[model samples]
Target chain A: MPINSKIVRRIGDLARIDLSITDVDMFSEQLGEIVDLMNQLDGVDTSSVQEMDSEIGNGHENRPKDIVNEGNCIELILKNAPETKEGFFTVKKVIE
Target chain B: MSDLASLTISKARDLLSTGEVSALELTEHYLQRIESSRNLNTFCFTATELALEKAKSCDRLMSSTDRGKLCGIPLAVKDIFCTQSLPTQAASKILEGFVPPYESTVTERLWKENAVLLGKLNMDEFAMGSSNETSVYGPAINPWQDPNEATPLSPGGSSGGSAAAVAADLCLAALGTDTGGSIRQPAAFNGVVGIKPTYGRCSRWGIIAFASSLDQAGPITKTVRDSAILLEIISGHDKKDSTSVRCEVPNFEAALNGDIRGKKIGIPKEYRIDDTPAEIIKLWEIGINQLSDSGAEIVDVSLPHTKYSLPTYYVLAPAEASSNLARYDGVKYGYRATLKDDEGINELYKRTRSEGFGDEVKRRIMVGTYVLSAGFYEAYYQKALKVRSLIKRDFREVFSKGVSAILTPTTPSPAFPLGSKNKKSPVEMYLNDIFTVPANLAGLPAVSIPTGITEKGLPLGLQIIGPAWEEANVLNIAHRLEKDSNFRIKPKQWWTS
Candidate 1:
């Protein structure tokens, strides 16, 4: 495997996600095939190719100030939060 | 009236304007069609009452001088967009009930033109899968069939429901966001018109983020004209999305004169894949001859880096997706797991995310995190970025040859049996977007139009890709091709009694 189970676990931790034992096994196999697919990029000579940092949308990076900057949905945004109190999101306490 | 939903957006526009049909009546008609088409599962949420009410108001407003081309036209919205009253879940459990109080900039623009929202359509979970099978509500079935066999076929994803709805006549048109062919692929599968406008042509403000750099909102409709008109209404400079271009919004519909007298159409040599079915190859030949017959010069082009696009996209998209989707932790919003008495914050994040995201989403996020990790970043992610630039340059080079558009088969095959892809490995399914991904990777405009039917008795689509910010050109060529193909095959009403 280009990537192993331990590495997959490490990735899960970084992504703030959990993988079931079955998913871990399945992903290990699936991602191995996918990684092998990624290795195909090694065959291409991209030495002179400049890495794409931005994107093709609106080739111009410079823009005037934002025309609409209203983020006034504090209440509406909080409506879907799992736990909320006084307009702030709540989570399990970590520090002792 | 049962088939009133089958009317094209342009025709419906004319009908409503002439008072031949009230917007209320039109909305009611589609709402009933939507109810009967439940077996297709095209809609994730139907805004029946709201649609009727909006149609009533639109009817009343028609008494005055204020109106637009889309006034009183009923359209379906992909669940990915955040509509005020409609819960935009993106067909994933994580956002099961995550309704935004505000509307997406694109959908907001729709209402500005008096277009009625019929409901939110279904899609892949977080727009991750090629087959709609990844959706939490189960796969949205392709309405196309072989007439005799009862085997359910898939409407391609991640905009599966949007394509299915448009194909099945559940809505005149729908809003579908494309990242790596989500919009175009499904449109091809369902034999509908779907355009993925040049990146940043339409604002990405309220549409849920997938691969942020690659995701762009466009329209899926029944005809080239409808897609063009919807694209016009939904596209513009939005201060909310800084990436939106300052380029003047052209009269997209008016630009559809179908005059391609001297335009050069590119046929990429690399797109002739070894595994492509002979039927699809024949369709491509037919499309080429038709375009040439319309007085357009046909030129063979080469996109050497085409083979690398899918690999590079898989790497970069998931990497960006991992970063973009990081916001779904338990604290901020979306689905969260119930914390046990002994649970801690770490458990909160993991349990919530594990419970929230589906298998495909989780796989991508893990792969994304893996590629971006310290050691692999140089070997994988950075390399993929360089390769991405090569892929983009390939399109630039071809366009520089004075090629206004490149013609290719939308899907290697027509729509497949719904669960057929499930039996294969994820890599096999990822191969489904082989042709459609290049345009997205280049951030160029592309459209899928129904070309003909396969021997399997299913409809197939052909794709035309254009240079960045050249959607008008792409649509014009598509409009020309639509007339040439004269494809009028509709799916047999097998699902309805």
Candidate 2:
């Protein structure tokens, strides 16, 4: 099935990236075939196969202990931010 | 040591231990080489000042018996690895001029071993492309060019810079991360050694995340033993990455005793697809005979789900990449787009991300978001995960039946001319990673060692994959094959002149 241009635009919005009309047209054509290729997975019967998360091996033994820890570099942490004011990240106001 | 620039880690070690060559002298030689070979565009950033200072320190420690194995050696770091106070852009406009205040665990360990930083090497934008064409800074040209045409051949990627630097002899060895065949495929194209150790073997702390599950760090070097030496230094447990396995690091170099006698090497029949080139199949057969001649028991194995690896990798890698790349908002680190009067927070995010990401990256994020969206999640993303399990089970069954390693071609064919393939869409590009994805999906160790040069006089690679955390056996098999094949096809030094 053709992945509709509307679906592509929705995905682009979901990903929070703006797309020109040209990109939507081009990407929808490409993504449609890629998603169709990915649909090949449906042919394989995986009824009893347990999903593997690479190294995790379907187990949670590697999870670190939960504890609060302080990082040493607050100034450095704020160093790369585009807008920082009074030691807090600043962004455009969400509420009027 | 007349030709200082071409020395390997093991060769350089022998000379350094005997006080034949000072570390400072070695660093200066490589710095000069990096500058002279500027035409290749292999090195995106280099630090002569920092390298010399560290080389002096390395020289001072040479007198002590407690010196580390990599003491006084110079290495190129991929831009994807965070080096404290140095630019680590991953060759993307989004991360242009972004310097981390801390070091990646892998790089920190290399520095602790007294390895000199030769500066950051070029790569695909966020490690995304099979060819190096997608890099924002421009492609890192493969040192090997076809004889007749001026058109540059690709070095393969996203570790293209690492491979080109090693093949060009810019550094002794380099570190590279492979999410899906980045290390191995690039190494194959460049005629060198590249290995991607099992996932959880190297800590992911400070390394830029492309795909969290498949991304792994390993070494790219000139020889198999050099790869073993570097791998031994870089692989181990780390508290910083929780997924890092807490096991004792093995002596990988010592394990390369050239002893693969009575070992079962699997040749997956599924790897021989109909469309695969005869030359590549011939090299695979040669690799089989070479190993079998060395007393390894060659067994025909079947990974029935092998054909679906590339499609599954595309789904899973992108899904994770969409999540990992979400942090790059204009409010945080790296490049931020200029806002217009009407733009608010949502607009800022949309514009910043749209401006920051390249075409390929944008394509992936959209594909990823589509799969994870509410309606299609069950049909695509969930289905891909289940298929991944079957691919892993294929390896488990073969390995459990006493197969020490699986031998196959590292890439479908030798290096094609850059821009010759992948002109229309990414399907042809993604297909290039077919043979090398199963090892990543299974979290197993895989290496690409040059087997022979092609009819076009380009390098080809044979891959050896071992079960999880059994890099020792895999390295041993590759080491034996290296000696048996004795395929030493070096690129003509056209770029250096």
Candidate 3:
């Protein structure tokens, strides 16, 4: 499947990255080539194979009980924030 | 003091135990070397005061019987690992000025063993690129130079700085993360030893996420024994990381008895790709002979799904990266673009991400998002997952056949000159990870030991990969090969005045 500039633009938007016209043109070509590379997978018949979700054998069974093990360091959590107000992360207003 | 920089962790430990050299003295020597070799661009940030303070503490603890394994060893880390209060930008502009509040489990363990932090090393932005060219700090130039070529070579990445620092003797060893061939490939290119332990061997807590399932942390060092020591210290179960297995942390260094007698070593026939450079093939043949000479039976095995590994990796890694990177939405931390008066939150997100991420990172995000889109998810993501199963099964089958480990070339070619990679085609660069990616897909223990040099005096490495959680087996074989190869060549200190 050939990836067109239109599709590349949509992917950029889905990823929340603003792409320029030049970026769309370039990614269309580069991603097309990469898709061609990925197309090689179609040759192998994986009809009987199960999806490998993770390399490790164990699942979330190893997770500790659902409890708040860590907290109370509001200052540390907010230290790297771009904007903060009164112990809360401040972002651009979402509601009018 | 200058010569002290060349000492390995093992040697320095002996000297420190005897009070022949103080920890502060050793740390000062490495600090001086790091200062002098700034032209290599290996370090993005230097924690000079922190290192001196840690060294002083180690010196004070010299009288105590409860000293840790890596006490007073001055080491740097790939900027991907979060270090509290220190800049932990994963060498990307998106994470500029982002100091992590917590240290990564691996680094925390290292500090528990009293390892001193030299600073944070440069790497490919988000650990995305094969060459260090994608780094926000610019390319960390390879200390190894081709005499005939005027262009500087790549140290290979995303652990480029870790390998370069170890190669240049700027530090004893450095921590590096391997997502695809990040650690081993760079170590091969820089004539150093690096081992990516089993996927869950080290906890991923506090490390910047790239591909959640694929990333594993390891050490880049001057010797195989040094890597073994560091791996033992860093490997253990972490409840913080559910994927971190509840396995025994063996004394990896003690397992290096150099006895591979009667061990069955498999040579996967499919790795002999047609485009592989002749030097790499020659070195691989040499490696096979060395292992066989040590009484290990060399047998030919097949991994038919080997060709599919790289494509599967490209699809799946990006899919996970797209999801993992969504946290950087210009709200909480890192770089946030200045917004216009009328710009909405969505616009802020798009602008910040667009302005912050590099070309390669954006390319990956685009690819990942497209693959996981509703229309293409089944075709790309699901298919890649099934192929991943086959790849894992291939390794499992080979291991079940009494084959203790698999030996292959760590890379198809030695380090190429910086900026020589074709910008138009990204797949060409992705090919560098071909030989090393299969092990990661299987979550196996693999080590790259510097075994030979190319005709141009550049280093080449032979890899030994063992079954999952068998890091000791992998390191033992690597130690045998390291001793037999006697690869002691180091790049000249051209950057020093």
Q: Choose the strongest candidate by TM-score.
A: 3
lDDT by residue for model 3 (B133-186), tens: 999999998999999899999999999999999999999999999999899999
Backbone atom clashes (below 3 Å) for every candidate: 2, 0, 0
Candidate 3: TM-score of chain A is 0.86
Q: Which prediction has more favorable TM-score, 2 or 3?
A: 3
| Residue-level lDDT tens digits of model 1 in B191-217 | 899999998889999889999889999
For model 1, the stretches where C-alpha displacement exceeds 4 angstroms are: A56-58, A64-73, B1-3, B422-424
Over 4 Å off, model 2: A58-60
Question: How far in Å is the alpha carbon of A55 misplaced in model 2?
Answer: 3.0
DockQ of 3: 0.74
Q: List the lowest-lDDT window of 10 residues for candidate 3 chain B.
A: B1-10
lDDT of 1 by residue, A16-66 (tens): 887888877888888888899888889998788778878733465776765
B109-204 per-residue lDDT for model 2 (tens digits): 999889999999988889999888889888888888778667898889999999999999999999999999999999999999999998888889
Candidate models: Cα lDDT each: 0.88, 0.89, 0.92
Q: Local error of candidate 3 at B197, Å?
A: 0.6
Write down the C-alpha DockQ for each prediction.
0.73, 0.69, 0.74
